[model samples]
Target: MPDRIFDFEKDFAGSLRCIPMAVRLKLDLVGIKLSLRQWSRLDRDQRGRLLEVPCGGAADRHTIGAMIEEWVTATGGTIDRIDPADSANWSNTNTVPEVVVLQAKGEDVSAPSLSQWRALTDQQRFALIKLTRPGHENKNFVPAMREFGLFLAD
Candidate 1:
């Protein structure tokens, strides 16, 4: 909700080296797959629209989904859906999920306690879930945690 860009994203902000959280959230809401190529095809105005678009109401979701389809098609990209179970995992906050705990252990970092995990904003939680997913490169997991203020800045 803060519309904050992480310091880790600064290198990519100018060239869109990676898909930012704002655009990723929009893609998630619409059940669309967006490749970096498709993202590059979008002009600044289009990317700005993604960052600013409202996707809260049911009607808004429909409209945004349609808009994303059109953009993806125009860019010669394909669409895809994330599994509901995987999506649901991000919203669960009752405890720190084991995968994340394992990821932290692998990194030799302490997994946050349940209260710290619960206190994270949905976006922060979502980012952590995305980062810690098995077989993911996971290069950004620690950086995301630092950006989310779960760890001190170096």
Candidate 2:
């Protein structure tokens, strides 16, 4: 599937005001951490290239990795590399994450079932995990769950 900038992110996605989850996932995959402030300093074209660059194979990873390194340097940001773990909560299809469920339950919303969670695309799962993070805005959590058909906000 093509890279996505989800509907909840559309408003800022056009302006790159906030980094899209697709790019965020790619950054995670490549072990780079990009902050929104640093991301905003980049020109629109560069931001667009980041979204367009193929991010699948090892060769593609190298290409985007180099591009991100250049962009980080130009933006006066240092890359804080993180090794993406294969065992992350989002990567686990066997069970739904408790925090996600609790966050939803906090709002009286139902979180996804195991079957539904397992059915989600990695990026979709990533978006949910991100939307539920501590101190990060949880406003989009329900919308995302709805978008993924994992919940119906009543």
How high is each candidate's TM-score? 0.84, 0.88
> What's the CA error at residue 41 for candidate 2, in Å?
1.5
Question: Candidate 2's error at 72, in angstroms?
Answer: 1.9
**Model 1 pairs whose backbones collide:** none
lDDT of 1: 0.72
Provide the lDDT at 87 for model 1: 47
Task: Give lDDT: candidate 2, residue 112.
Answer: 86
lDDT (0 to 1) per candidate: 0.72, 0.81
Instruction: Give one digit per residue, the lDDT tens place, for model 2 in 64-124.
Output: 7888888888777877778853537777898898888888897678878889999998889
Task: Write candidate 1's Cα lDDT for 43-79 as tens digits.
Answer: 7787777777776656776787787778877877765
How many clashes show up in model 1?
Answer: 0
lDDT of 2: 0.81
Worst 10 residues of 2 by lDDT: 78-87
Q: TM-score for model 1?
A: 0.84
